[model samples]
Target: DAGVTQSPTHLIKTRGQQVTLRCSPISGHKSVSWYQQVLGQGPQFIFQYYEKEERGRGNFPDRFSARQFPNYSSELNVNALLLGDSALYLCASRATGTNEKLFFGSGTQLSVL
Candidate 1:
C-alpha cells in the first residue's frame, strides 16, 4: 500500500563529487520517473522508465542519469556534481495508462557546496 519511497532523505556534497538517489515505487506499478526541483522553480522532468527501459529524458546534461530495476524501483545518478545541481530529486510512479497521474515520493534533497 505504500505510494512511493525515496532513500537518504537528504545528501550534501562538494563540487565534482557524485551522488546516487534511490526510489521504490508502489506495488504493481511499472513506470518510474525522476524530476529535479530547484528553489523558486517547478519540477523539471529528468527521466522516465517503463518496464525497466528508458522511456524519456529531460534537458539535463550528461551528468544526470537513471535506471529502473526489474522490480520497478529506480535510482538517479548525478555525476560531476555542481552547485547548480542542488535541488529536490523527486521520484514518481504510475500504472500504465495515458491518463494516470504520477504518485510521488517526498524526494531527496541534495546540496552541493
Candidate 2:
C-alpha cells in the first residue's frame, strides 16, 4: 500500500495570510497526525486524531487547527500566518494497536514571507 501523502508539496504565503494543507493516510490506518520540523530541530509533536476524534495537541498557538475526516484523512489549517510558522508540516498515521509504529509523510513545505 502507498505511504502517507500530502498535497501542494510546496507553497508560499505572506504574513497574515491563511493556508490549508491536506493529507491522506496509508490505507487502513485509523489515525491521522501532525508534527513540525524547524531549521535544526527534531520533529515536534503538534496534533493527532484517531477514530475521527482529536486525541492530542501541541503547544502551538490558536492559529493552528486540524480535523480528521470519517475516512481518517486530515486537513490542517493555519490562520494569520507568520514567518515563524514556515516549516515542513508533516503528516503521520498509525494503525490502532499496541506497539504499532507511526508512519510519516514527506511533508508540505510552507514558506511565510
Candidate 3:
C-alpha cells in the first residue's frame, strides 16, 4: 500500500498558511525494526522482526529485545534500563522482506527519569 505523503510538500509554500492537514501511513507490515538515536548522532540499530520472528539482531547488548504480536504490533523491552538508554526510540516496518523498503516511525523520547 502507498503511504500518505506530506502536502504543501514543505518544499514550496506561500506566505500565509491556515490549512490543517493530517499525514499518516497505513499500518500492517511483514517486517519491523527498532532504532535508538542519541543526541547529535544517527540512529543505532536495536532489533528486527519478520512475521513475529526475529530475523536479525544488532550490535546492541542483551538489554534490548522486541516481541511481535499476532496483530503485527511490537513491543520493545530493555532489561535493567540504564541512564544511557534514554534516547529517541524509533520503529520501522516493511511490507516485503526485512531488507526491502522500510517505513519509519516518528520515534518517541525515552527518559531515564
48-96: candidate 2 lDDT, tens digit per residue: 8998888999999989999999888999999999999999999999888
Cα lDDT tens digits for candidate 1, 17-112: 999999999999999999999999999999999999999899999999899889889999999999999999999998887577999999999999
Question: What TM-score does each of the candidates earn?
Answer: 0.97, 0.96, 0.72
Best by lDDT: 1
* Model 2 steric clash pairs: none
Kindly indicate the candidate among 2 and 3 with the higher lDDT. Answer: 2
Predicted structure 2, TM vs. truth: 0.96
Return the clash pairs for model 1, or none: none
Best to worst by lDDT, what's the order? 1, 2, 3
**CA lDDT for candidate 1:** 0.94
Candidate 2: segments with Cα more than 4 A from true spot? none
Q: What is the C-alpha RMSD of each candidate to the true structure, in Å?
A: 0.8, 0.9, 11.1
Candidate 1 regions with alpha-carbon error over 4 angstroms:
none
